[model samples]
Target: MVNDPHPPLHEYQRSGDYVVGGIVSHAFILADSIDFTIEPPPPSLEEVTVVPKNYQHILALAFAIKEINENPQLLPNVTLGFQIYNSYFTARSTYHATMLLLSKLERFIPNYICEFQHDLIAIIGGLDAQTSLYVATFLDNYKIPQLIYGPAPVMNEKTPGLPFYQMVPKEDVQYMGIRSLLLHFDSDLVTVKGDICTGEEKLENLPGPFFEMSMTGHSYSIYNAVYAVAHALQAMSSGRLHHKAMADGGVLKIQHQQLWQLHHFLRGVSFNNSAGDMVSFDENGELVAGFDIINWVVSSNQSFQRVKVGSVDPQAPPDQAFTISVNAIKWHSWFNQVQPLSVCSESCLPGSRKKVKEGKPFCCYDCIACPEGKIASQKDVNDCFECSAETYPAETQDFCVPKDVSFLSFEEPLGISLTCSAFSFSLITALVLRTFMKHHNTPIVKANNRNLTYTLLVSLLLCFLCAFLFIHRPEKVLCLLRQTAFGLIFSLAVSCVLAKTITVVLAFMATKPGSRMRKWVGKGLATSIVVSCSLIQTGICTVWLATSPPFPDVDQHSMVEEIVLECNEGSVTMFYSVLGYMGFLAIVSFFVAFLARKLPDSFNEAKFITFSMLVFCSVWLSFVPTYLSTKGKYMVAVEVFSILASSAGLLGCIFFPKCYIIVLRPELNNKEQLIRRLY
Candidate 1:
């Protein structure tokens, strides 16, 4: 069957060929394009197995394929199909299914792509981390991207480069919680470990002898994934055939793009999924770096009583603090960095290093290190330690032979050579900038020079990004970094605005015959004013933090984690404080422009500043409300909008006037002509 490009959709009888975008597509032109019929490219494998039946992965994949087939006018006439096999439980069963899929794919590969020329991508489902690991490797061998709706760290750990992507919290993050719990508990001599429960029979049956004695799994993760996907697909579906298909295609493609850019597919996209808080992955594709740890106590009857553990919200909220209990449970952990020494002392006795022995004092045991040049991440007394990268162990005794650094470079976890290179790069950039400034003084001297602004803005941007990373998902060192970066950027921006205002005031006052401030208002005054403004803001911030200590809450409202910290951006007072300062500058600049209207028309700097302020303020004012209204990726988008708009305003004000004169009034290029025209 072929679809006509100009088919009268209203008159055409409903058929299997078209899928609508929504439940009420009859009243809406949901689809705006034409569909074409191209054969699906091919399937890498004929029979692919989905382990543990991840509802969301299946749902998303199903909708994606359905959409490609039914897009109105997109592929005017095409049919796409998929074959799904379920790998219910256990690693052994998962392995069996993988082999079956492999065998079938071998037979279908040559013809599948040609037969289905239009369908180039295949989505495999594995909300189960263990199972997905096996499936991801299988798909990676074929150069396909597998969207795993499972934990992040598991996928990465199992196959780091196997093209496996995730839309859930990573296991590394889960470990973050575990590690935090261990540290917090040990520090205070609290003898308890957090347990995980997944509400699955298979997980329930799995033995826990090898891992942490306190670790267990729960069903909340699986539940959340299932319902979240269902909600998104439900919203995306249409009752009509054509529109429905188009929506599906659009959503799938958009989601892929978002994931590629390191955003979470569902939560990060700002899709409502009934999660308590609107969940979204951060820039690293991690929804939450730390989970709540509940200490489990076994009663005499064997019933477990789980006490609440501390919550780690990177952007902590007000009123939540580092506490031991919340809502009936004692929080045993909050994510914070544990020193390598805390885990095991850096200095060890002659015959022993650091090690963990399951049955001893807080699980501490002695570890032995071999003779010089030999290293291992883990070592226990009496057990032979494996040699670290760059060294190979000799069969005879506890000694290591060094390998060439080049050969060991890629394999080491923290490659020594690469670390040194990164440090050098930073040093070089700093030295070059310092040298340039020393040689070219105008950049430092100019009050509103474009070169100066550019340099400052670049540095400010780096500072902003660094601040984000420093406190991002807050652990130990991040706290200090976050605060410092925030203070620095706030100071810089405020200082810039203040300097501009002073420049305007001084320039206007200079027009008067007798004004002492005018004589003092040169490059030195501008620099001094800028520095003073920055220092003032910094002082205010420091005082506020000292008086009302802030905790870390990932969300601005700060309800999830019980520990909010003082940072540059989270507080309402901070927001208003900065806004107030900027607002004052804007008002003064406007006033200066109004007064300058009577002055010689050649002085249009005030007018330019006024224009820039209007745009800048409008952008920020609109941003506050929009930012407050959104939770995840959409909130992030609002910030992006504010940034882009502010930049555009600055660019227009700086360039638009010059562009007008050059392009529209070339005759005014001459200084005499420009002055005469302005007058």
Candidate 2:
């Protein structure tokens, strides 16, 4: 239907404190007024789109006010009445309807000047934001409170103090309801970059079975808004009654208060409605009502059906605030009746992490495998984390594995092999010492200073035994003994070899007639060399112990899934210094033995000493780089192997020839073989 002026409306009953005027849109007009000429009266609206659901909003307001007047406990003797007006979905019609609601309703009385005029106390603003704002702005001048029953207005600083209370939840709540619907079906809301829909919309001639009394929609808001005013009026009447009772028997008067000032009474109103839902306002005068989630399904007749699938209550606990029924609703044909997947890339599995894609939204990402020494134990984990000190990432890099207490213990195969090596070398050194003791009086055994020979053999035996310190699980006492014992014992053996080299030189030099070096060729000279050299090493070891000693420690990061119990050289500098000093002794002995190797003395063992020193130097020279490169228990194994190998080299290269002569070639051990070298 097309119209340009006001259609006739049925007259109101004119009861209660004053009529509650409702401004609702029954139809939407197509175009805006174009001509800017001042037409004296407002522009007329035409070419409308009929909306049956909004027309029911007008009926809902009358129903609520009539229901409140029939209730015995509410507004007992004061009945409530209502008057409805058409907004016609236009600004001029909204303003005209609001002005008519506030003007005097009855004018032709016998005593027109003396008769009481019906004034609108409050207004239920229309079914959309534009109509609500128009009526709200006009009513604001008269200090009247307008309740918005449709969409909440997008108010800003410029429109503040307009004095309107929102009856429906804010527009953001509609978006949240949709979000909950998607989340309950295990899907995510996608980002759609598209153009805005700015065309005007009209709801008409497209539906079947449109409205129901039980449906919680915008029409329900109109019903609640009218009852809210009734409760405010009831509260105001009760306060007046209590004030009169407190006075000295004052006569009761009715209908004397200004209804427009009920804005003051409405502010203090808080009560439960007939539906048992509490109707209250926040500090900003907007009602704190949540939204009911409805599923609108278009049937074969092309009409949308509202099904209650969920509700969003802000008053509930945070975790329980939003809920939805997935099976109770229907999905679009594009989803194929199956729940839609989340609008994102496939989730990153365990042992993997998310790598965000460039030039895209944050949720869009690439799933990458976790790096070494770290783990991602959950799906779609944003980042991978390293395990704790006592744990490590599992082989799959999905979870943390507690580290086993690992060491070169006597139980494992490597530890058993090292232990056998140390023990066998120790036994061979002992037997060599015994063989030398049995042949002490022979020219071969007595040629080198016998006392120095005994000391050298003893030190070698101790060196082999010290390897046991590096075999077991490293402890406080063992850590204290491990490096120091190896250093001191190896230092003594190398010093003995150096002293013998010096003794052989001194003996050949002292053999000359009238030589003063004869006095120094005795035990005193060899004794001083051994004692002084060993004493220097002893002092160095003492200082190392006094400052920083080796301590037991665990290596966690050395291996991917194992923690190693090993000795931590407390002062790494001191540890290397000990090895350096022993190396110096070997080098000095090696050069001296090489120079004297061809000396014409049957007892000269300088050639063998040079070979032994060479082996010791080579083994340790390689040990430094290999030790630095290894990790965890493997490092301890390397140190133990080095100790055994170098000790075996010294014992084999130096003493093996003597053992062969003394045990198997006794004929060569006689004095006849001891040809003194002519100096």
| TM-score against truth, every candidate | 0.30, 0.61
Write the residue-wise lDDT of candidate 1 on 175-247 in tens digits: 5544454444433222333222232111121121111223222233333333333333233332223455765
- Tens-place lDDT per residue, model 2, 1-679, is 2232344222111111112223443211101111111111222344223323334665666567667767877766665554455665667766666665554441222323333333336677665566777877777776777787665566788788777777766445545654665445433332211011112111222222211112245556777777777787777767877978736344323345665667877777788777887788877777776666665666677667777676777778877778767677675454576644435577688999989889866667899999988999887778999989888888889999898878888899999989998999999999999989987988788878789999999999999999888888788999999889988899899999999898887787787889888888888877888888888888888999999988888787777667888888889899998999999999999999898888766755888888988998999999999999988888889988988898899889888988988888887777765653333
Residue 564 shift from truth in candidate 2, angstroms: 3.6
Lowest-lDDT window of 10 residues in candidate 2? 27-36
| True-structure lDDT of candidate 2 | 0.70
Runs of candidate 1 exceeding 4 Å displacement: 1-491, 514-517, 544-575, 597-603, 655-679
Clash tally, candidates in order = 69, 0
Give Cα distance to truth, residue 109, candidate 1, Å: 99
Indicate which candidate wins on TM-score.
Answer: 2
